[model samples]
Target: MADAEGDRITLSALQDTQAIQGQTVILPTALGVAPVETTGDPRIEAGWFDNGLKRARKELGQADRSVGDERLPVLIVTRYLVDGTLHEDRAIYDLGFALDGQLLGGTRVRIRGLSLITRVPAASGQAKLDARWKQLHPKLAS
Candidate 1:
């Protein structure tokens, strides 16, 4: 959906994502009685927006002006919850700007890549999720 406040145009999308299936593997231990398992969680759902579009535009413009180019790097991190599942998503966006440092609203924002980790119900998924998230937080934040 699109909203206009004065001169700035705001765009938003909810229910715009699709769920990705997860996998779990079980391996036999050396003793042949115990099991070792590993899991890869799925992304259930996510919603993203930094509260306002005007603010984002200003920041992008400032970054472009500082670098004297429109090829500015943007990192988008989003967190959301649905039906007890927690979703964390990160994406790298390549924004296009004009020669005057104005945001090119009509230009397509290229998504270079994305990483998504989700927490879902399982025998021992929450703990593993927490530990993995903790380990990845520092790197992702930078």
Candidate 2:
């Protein structure tokens, strides 16, 4: 949707699916994951996940800037839950269950990207959904 000035526009997903709703939409940082250390302890795998989350948060913050001279809204959905098979490179932790089967309650979505980890609520039909998203995920805003 375009603002009153018509120079800046806001865009967001219209679908309610987990893939579209929960995905931590971020711009690519590196071409791919850095070369894995062959000799490192298997326990370091957790560290890799932590580093990835940090990078994803950083990139999402950059994408939240307003348009033109005015501030526009940007939404960041994290830990988005999905029901289908994600490709090898795309899959994060397997919730190991169907989206419908799980009792998500207030949890709207969950995203686990290569370097991103977050969750967001199902979008309310608001013009300022982006701003609301930022409000909900303060860490990403930082």
- Report the lDDT tens digits of candidate 1 across residue range 57-126: 4433322123332322223234445455766444433232222223643322221222323423445443
List of clashing residue pairs for candidate 1: none
lDDT of 2: 0.29
lDDT of 1 at 56: 41
Clashing residue pairs, backbone N/CA/C < 3 A, model 2:
22-80, 78-111, 78-118, 78-119, 79-110, 79-111, 79-118, 80-110, 80-111, 81-110
Model 1 TM-score, 2 decimals: 0.27
Model 1: residues >4 Å from true position, as ranges?
Answer: 1-11, 14-69, 101-142
Task: Residues 1-142, candidate 2: write the lDDT tens digits.
Answer: 3333232223332346534323332222221234232211111122223344334435656332222221112223333234663311121211110011126432111121122232333443122443443443344435
